[model samples]
Target chain A: MSGPIDFYFDFASPYGYFAAGAIDALGARYQRTVNWHAIVLDANFQSLERIRIPSSVMRSDYIRRDVERVASFMKLPYKAPSSLGLHTELAARLFYWFNDRDPQQSRAFAQAVFKAYFVEDRNIAQLEVLQQLCCPLQMTPDDVASVAGDSATRARLKAEIDMAEARGVFGSPFFIVEGERFWGNDRLPLLERWLDAGTY
Target chain B: MSGPIDFYFDFASPYGYFAAGAIDALGARYQRTVNWHAIVLDANFQSLERIRIPSSVMRSDYIRRDVERVASFMKLPYKAPSSLGLHTELAARLFYWFNDRDPQQSRAFAQAVFKAYFVEDRNIAQLEVLQQLCCPLQMTPDDVASVAGDSATRARLKAEIDMAEARGVFGSPFFIVEGERFWGNDRLPLLERWLDAGTY
Candidate 1:
């Protein structure tokens, strides 16, 4: 009788990239559906009144090292991005566009994007880069572009971000299970426990 | 052959309060000594150029929920402090003063301070409040004041904070295991794993 687990994230967040790899399998282990939502983080950062992390020297250094360490611990392949904090708005919009029709395809799209950024060190903010990523998912670059730029598709992505903020999701790789909010990739263990034991 | 785990924290941090409950036991499980250090966070926050939590409306609400949930998860008793961000400079300074002399008593003193702030909702910033805390440790209030007021003690505490900053500790409840840094209470599990089987 439980609802699907909501896994909200920004594609640009490396932690989000890390969470993406594990969340689905975790959901399957608990017999729950993992609903992936790629939402923009700019609005959340604005509300928190903080600058993007890669813009800061100290935080970025910590994050760079932490990501590598976390990747090693999680046993996921990770390479530092050539550029950090690349704008993820287009990637998010395309995810909603694909998700509206096919949830499975959208997840594949997300994985490809994550690999492109974290593993390949590609600049995901560029349209050509994103378009090249679509080929592996069997998505046409032209079709991907058209849908990502559609007004309705943009609106859908915006609404998701708005809902995330209203739900008090102020960080990436956020999860909500039956109204309980757990933020950050670090909280995944707690999320798994909640899904398994229905919270303490 | 294992080194003492350096557990750095700030008294005013809620996460620090939560971590204090379990760090020593975790160290014991691995047969490692937990060396507690109450370092100032103001310098780190200034370097990061960010306002402290509990000062922000949205963040404080999330933290209140997070601490309670984390406490429930850890099976520890917790109550939200009536006030937030009470200055802990005096508490930290006194901790170093006592720690230099007797490591055991300083740890007990720290536990008392954590309980006073988190469980009792006592404002720990007050000198008299700290004096009252020392009584339980069998130290007279005057004696507590004398050591905390010593310029040499204050200088020692400042030096610790300076060293922590240089080592790239930018958050409370920070841990360094075998020359590797892990920040936040959320990283405790990773720290435990590193201690048990060595790092990946």
Candidate 2:
């Protein structure tokens, strides 16, 4: 229970964005480190042969109303992006790229990407938006292009996806500590309790 | 805000069963009445043409693990039934049947049915099991058979489904307070806050 927490999420997930704000703070309070693993939701399900998440948020009205109210309830800044099917793999690739060099900066970059797409209504699928996001963090466009063009980054993401598959991670905002699995943003209270008591 | 809370849920949903224990207490604390509408998840999605919840809990390992932890987290008694796709419509019919005469008894019967399946590992789909559940409530076998034999109860369930469709309900453990929709058992906290503050 005192062990480090592992977070597995897809960048396209809104709940993942919402959870990004609180996860680090929770880890800090508990004095445990959080390990962020970026995986694609599409890849996770395609492997399981379970239901495929719709490529567009426009396909599900329930998700639209649910996330909007959730943002309001969670007091997080949120605006619906025109398209949800953006460059999740690219964002994740860049995350691993930054993550290898400086994990702290990678966390910052992840937050920026979430904010850009969710709050600012920017299309992160495009390279320019990601480059603009990277600029503030001292990452040059060449750095992004290098990662994008590299087949090695593609292999890195595949390894992450393979790791997720090994762990049976089926949803976003998944948490694992001491072999206990908790899924979805709503389960955080339970995860927090486990962290508090060292067992539930 | 002081208006009655509408709860839409499917009996097959373990979270819905977990939620049943607390919703009444929440409503009573706020001096609000809870109107429980027993919905079948299968029908809800068939109408919407969305993803169908796997008929059997055995079909999905993830849901199985998720609900077991949730039951522990919520401190509710739960035993996985041998089969899940049984008698949801029958249970809904019986609830409405009693609701028309004695709402209190109907609530009690609803609780008993939930316990029979989730806590006792009994099948509510069996007439004998439901009848055994009814005995303590002073409802006789004739009363149960009469409803089962009647086409009226089938129509009654259809009406409930139609109403759910009109309300845009698509999941179990759905709550609507004055047109604000909250989905999932995890969302009860947010729903309670809305009740507490009158608006969030």
User: lDDT scores for all predictions?
Assistant: 0.82, 0.81
Q: How many backbone clashes does candidate 1 have?
A: 0
Worst 10 residues of 1 chain B by lDDT: B49-58
User: What C-alpha lDDT, on a 0 to 100 scale, does residue A103 get in candidate 2?
Assistant: 86
lDDT of 2 by residue, B1-200 (tens): 49899988777778889999889989999999999888876653454635344454335776777788788888888888887756587888888888888888888988998898888889887787878888898989888978866899878888888888778777788898988777788888888888998876
Interface RMSD of each: 4.5, 3.3
Predicted complex 2: CAPRI docking category: acceptable
Flag clash pairs in model 2.
Answer: none
Model 2, range A138-160, lDDT digits (tens) per residue?
A: 98999888887799998998898
Which portions of model 2 show Cα errors greater than 4 Å?
A49-58, B43-45, B49-52, B56-58
Please tell me which predicted candidate would have the highest TM-score against the true structure.
2
